[model samples]
Target: MTVYRRGLRFLRARRRAVAALAAWSVVEAGQTFLVGYALARALDEGFLAGRARTGLGWLGVGALAVVVGAYGTRRVYGCVAALVEPLRDQLVRHVVARGVREGDGGALSGLTQQVEIARDTFAGLVMVSRSFLFTAAGALIGLCSLDPLLLLVVAPPLAAGVALFALTLRPLARRQEAFLVADEEIAAHLGGICPALRDITAAGAEALVTADAGARIGVELRAARSLARRGVLRVACLAVGGQLPLVLLLATAPGLLAHGVTPGALVGALAYVTQSLLPALQNLVHGLGTSGSRLEVVLRRLTPDPPPAAAGPAVTRQAAGPTAGGPARPAAQPRPLGVPVCADHPPARGPALSVSALTFAYGPGAVPVIENLDLRVPRGAHLAVVGPSGIGKSTLVALVAGLLEPTSGTIRVLGQPVRGRAAHGRTARGGSARIQPVRGPTACGQRVLIPQEAYVVTGTLAENLGQLRPRPVPEAELRAAAEAVGLGRLMERLGGPAAEVDPRALSAGERQLIALTRAYLSYAPLALLDEATCHLDPEAEERAERAFAARPGGTLVVVAHRISSARRAARVLVLDGRRALLGDHDELVERSPLYRELTGSWSRADSKPALAPRDPDRVDPVAGPGLAGDRRHVVAHGPVGQMQAARDLGDGGTRGREG
Candidate 1:
């Protein structure tokens, strides 16, 4: 309905072009009328009456009408261009406006694909709609001039077929819309799952993931089948409208001849039926059937949603308590110190981390990877999350870090709600201005998350360390954090904190140390480390973990990489595909078989040849552990970056270490 109203409004605005197009179309209609009328005159007054020259002249007149119709069609193309180009431009503007105002992710798809579809469909609909209306008019009028009986024979079937086709339009449009939505949803589902396929297999969720993907694909299949069913009805309309008229006209021919119809008149009527009426009716049925409903659907999709009736461009959506006739809205009150308004309030009595009935999956219609999960960690508590590789340990860390939103349930940090990635200052919404990242001095800046692979930008070492702080970090604080996380050697070697940094030149372990130091310097009350120290030697990993756990009034959640890491935590959470188990390391070692197996594997790994941590202040700057010594480093599915275990020495270049 919106598309229909929009179409009428567009036509009204371009009345001059529409008028010019109609005038030319009338010339085409005259050509159609003359085509059959000239033949009838030729046979009745010239050829059949023994006047051959007059008959040839009548044929020539019909030929001349075709040339005039060609000129009219050329003019019609210009008028159609006038209408179509503006509509396309208007659609492009509407799509961009919606993308900017509403943050619609599908705007690119609309512009690149659907906008062009709408333009082409609208042009075709315009050409077919006008051509059918005037062509039908001319052919029908010519029929009446020939004989009333011929019109009677042809009119009923044509009217009946057009009505039948019209009946199919609404249902066809619904099917088209359904199919498009289903296709997009399935595409998104597949894109999401592809990156997680290895993880899904590791967790033994192959069957569940497969079932979820199948369900999404099934929806698309059903929609396509429904669309095809409507296509069958369109074919039925074609049979009734275009083909049935011929059969009826022939069956009623004998009666027309006996009822005072001449031979030349009979031939003329046949010409009108076969040449004029049939072709026009066929074009109308096929062209309108395919394009008319399609144009409507595209127009509806491209139209922007209407703005609120009472609101204006000047309205400030931030004022919560303002009324229509009340005093002017006041400015936002300043936040108390240590409070990042969009982040948690750090209530004294509440748990630092709270997750209740949380659920998540890779995509829409995907089975929940973390389903109905609940967790809570009190202030100053150290919790270790231990699980097999790819068992959603990182996912839990991401959810707590506000990088991912749970599908269902709540996540509250220090008594404040974090709205996923949007909570981290960048591109997030607040009152009138953009939201800022949560930060504080004692509570651990709102919270810090260090993932497995560290990210270091090209900047001074001091800049990288202070990246998370809301304000500039002091020189003393930077040096203290660097020494605390075992980055003193790297910092001094790279010419102190002021020296330029290239992330690619740093080893994986060195990068991890820098990220740890950055976290150490943040004001977050809680720290989430998702295997953040995995690349480090055991001793260096221990130092980093100990530094975070010792923070003032801070809570720590570490996705553990080794069995020894679990021993330091006050509590351990073990996640397997079937359920979640929680207890202290010693208690779990005694009672849980899975925990024992994991500890046993880690204990075995510890006895194997592993990298020994070098004392930063004592070790030779140019000489350090190389890939030649750490045999157990390749314990997992692939190589574990032994090249980053220490600096690359000349003789130890790319050695194929332990089997």
Candidate 2:
């Protein structure tokens, strides 16, 4: 009902054009009856009485009616354009807005394919429906004028055929919906697997992947076949309803002739049945059955139902600390490291980061990778996240960044919600604000994310770094930022900040450094580095992290790739799939067996066993108070001293890190 009303509203804007079209449709329908009447006159008043001149006059009038009907048909197309183009524009706008809000690329398919189908189908439906109504009315009236009893002979079978065709409508629509679903499934499967083809082949899983894609294709084929079978029933209904009326009229002709039905009137009745009534019914059935079904499917998808709310009250549990049983508890309410607790809510202060009752899965019915997770990071805090490979570390970052939506949960950055499906945020000042799902600064210079691989477009080095800013960055400021993040040498080599350089020519580490410099220059208060420094040397990595953390009111969340990173952070979060353990590096080493195992593994892999050990009681060479305590001393001397400290720890310091 909503879709119908909306479509009607669009049409109403062009009511003058529609009125013109309706007037033409009436003229066109009346011409058909006029032609039949003129022919009947020619036969009865002139040809039957053997008067050549009278018959010729009537035949000329019929030819004139044909010309008028042709003109009306030509004018109707112009009216259709006035109605359909606005509808297309409106649909495009709607699809674009929805796509941006949801971070969905699938809306492109609707804009390109489905929108055209709706436009063309809707126009055809309007034309065919109007023509059918007008033509059927004119044909029935002509039959009654020819012989009052003709209605009794023709109307019953035509009504039965229309009713039967209507009966098949629901089934036909269901098949269409099924076919469309199968087609989208095939497209999504292929799109997902195509980028990973090299990996599938290298892993000797090509055949398995191909088999899965083949199954989706098979489902699409079956759906198409089912839809075709239902379409054949529409053709059958048209024949039974349209052609049967003609057959009945012909069969009863002889009996009618004996009961004072003149040959001229009988011929006119045949013309009304063949030329106007049957053809109009046939067109109506095909138009409504096919186009009407397609329109319904497209509208339903464009305006899908809202997602259901969270199943129960928000699950609050601590994300860290020991339990009563002497083992770390699996969950707990997330409390800020240094904030006064309020009776109803924590006071919004600093660069806030909060996640509550977060859960996510790839598809409905798939096992959740991250479930019921909660965490809070206070303003200006540097927190490192550590987890085993495939334990949902990157997924967690993506959800918080608003690159992907959670099945159910909320992510707040700087106290403003990062928008996603079923997620909403409040501003730091305690007012509601809906943040867009884009990867840039939100309200309050909120956040930015740098992935492992940096993105560099073809432009001057300064342009790439300053892309996040609204205006161009000054040369001196760019140079200082480059020096701070260890990009000074690269900038000098490239012939200053204005030099044009292909991002592809740079090494992975250099690109990461460039990205780090960009993030450093951004006003965003919360910076998420997802192994963004994996390619840089330890000295370069530390310099970049320190530069970002030193920013005013800035908070840092690093998906740590090394134990040293966790040690450098004020706090560390160890996600092991089953649960999360949050605490400072020293406390985590004693309470989290997973954290100790990861550090021990790093020590062995780097051949620096003496630096990091399994026992927490040992004086750890890399993270012990002696070396960790010297961080402030090293930073006080400026970039040169920070670079020197990073170089000393570069090799055999921390290795075999995991995301």
Candidate 3:
């Protein structure tokens, strides 16, 4: 009731616009009246009187009335805009203010997606309601003027249909709300667990996870079935409101004519019901049923609740020791193994990459896949982001690269805030860290992102490598970069850097080599690799990554596909969808469960895990495909190498450290 009252007040505030809209609508009602009345007058006084020219003149009047009504319809749309924009702006201000005050994370979703839905649905609902109201008025009046009996035949069914639709409104809205909430819960639950499939598979919890996810899915299925049952009312409304009147008029026709109704009056009354009333009522049932309920739900969520009568005591998680007058500190949380990244630890030069309270989601009702995420990467640091597939590792890189915007919070690559718009922001200028926003393969020209499925152009290899650079790269620098990143062989095979590269002819690994060389030769200080080298062999990938990390005063962030990549990084970020765990490899092994499972999975897959289980006392160094481990020695299971060279790249990543 309160939400409704507030809506009435909003409409009342814009009464002048309402008046202008109604005035135009009245012209439309006049059009409806003329359509029926002109037909009847032409039949009785002209055609039946043998005056064909008079009958044709009356038909011309009805045609002219249609033109006037179209003009009025055009004006109605302008009036609708006058009402809708103000409502949208008002909701935006209120939602923003409340979100800031309450720290409600959903505020961004309301602003971007929900508020837009409200605006469109409100416009549709208004147009249908107004059209039905005035159209019913004009149509009923025309019926009564034709004959009193016509009104009696039509009124009962139309009223019954409207009443039935009105009865479904409250229940239908409740069903909609329930189904939406159920859907959200399912999305949120699946979002957390789906990305951790590697962990789940390694832990042997597949059956349990499936059953739990299935239960949530079943809840949504039931809700949808309930919503569909209610939709049957729409068909019933159409039958009674639009179809039943014709049946009744046809049945009562002979009796009505004997009661003194003229033939022309009968035909005009039928036109009024079918043309004006039936079409208007059908639209009203559909538009109001769907859009009206949606608008109500959206508006209620956007509106602020009344203040509580009294303030409640503040809730806090307290440590054992606290002074009587001082505020309580939060209880100790599980910090990662070394150099805790759970809290901000900026160096004197500030972090090279900083993300504060960053959040993102696919839709308004879907879960926030990344929420309140905070981290800082020091300048020139080698950081690896390791997670199971679909854990939003790529999305995180996209946000940092400024290819996509965060739902809330901020991302700064180097020192400049990342804005995902190329039209407004300029590329980086002046100092290296001073980057501007840009929407391209690179962000502000300070950071370069090498995505999976590398892109190759029809031009020469030199042109492809130099595309990221504003000035053409010298032939010597390009060749040096290619040789360093292990692309020297591919370059030689394809003739030379000057040769035109055919993308179709090149293998997937060859394309990745080209992209890697391109990123290495560019001036961007930060390199983001989102599984960019997946197509390459493990050794080739290692060489490329090391070359990029070894770039002077450069930082590297890799979305790792293997444990070797994670181990090579100085620091690692583990995203399990629920929370972020940041630490070094050995530290994460101790503190993070998801990272432990993921590392196990990647280690086995990356390494040729062809080891035979040996007794704890015996060091089975011979069965190891890549390593010769003694009792006191630990070999880091690393990137694949050939024969004797491979033995040094250990696979025995167990409960001990390397000597």
Best by TM-score: 1
Q: Per-residue lDDT tens digits of candidate 1, residues 1-659?
A: 37678789999999999999999999978888888888888998899999999999999998998999999999999999999999999999999988998899989999999999999988988888898889888888988898778788878888888899888877887887788778878888778667556434322235556787798889889989998998898778767876787887678778888997767777777777688767776777777766776777677778854755775557665545677787877744422122122243334557888888888887899767688888888988999998765567777777776767778889887776767755543211110110122244322336777765466666798877766656666566677777767888899999988899997688767887888887776666677887677767668888888878887677889988677679999999998753788999889999888788778767754432243323332222111111112422232213221221233342454633211
Which candidate tops lDDT?
Answer: 3
- Per residue, candidate 3 scores C-alpha lDDT tens digits across 224-246 of 89989998998898889878998
Candidate 1 clashing pairs?
443-524, 443-525, 444-523, 444-524, 444-525, 445-523, 445-524, 446-524
TM-score for each candidate, following the candidate numbering? 0.57, 0.49, 0.52
What are the clashing pairs of model 3?
A: 626-647, 637-650
Ranking according to lDDT, highest score first = 3, 1, 2
RMSD of each: 12.8, 18.0, 22.1
Q: Enumerate residue pairs that collide in model 2.
A: 317-332, 317-333, 318-332, 318-333, 417-425, 539-646
- The Cα error of candidate 3 at residue 348, in Å, is 55
lDDT of 1 at 441: 33
In what order do the candidates fall by TM-score, top score first? 1, 3, 2
Model 2 CA lDDT for position 135: 87
Give the range of the ten consecutive residues with the poorest summed lDDT in model 2: 426-435
- C-alpha RMSD in Å of predicted model 3 compared with the true structure: 22.1
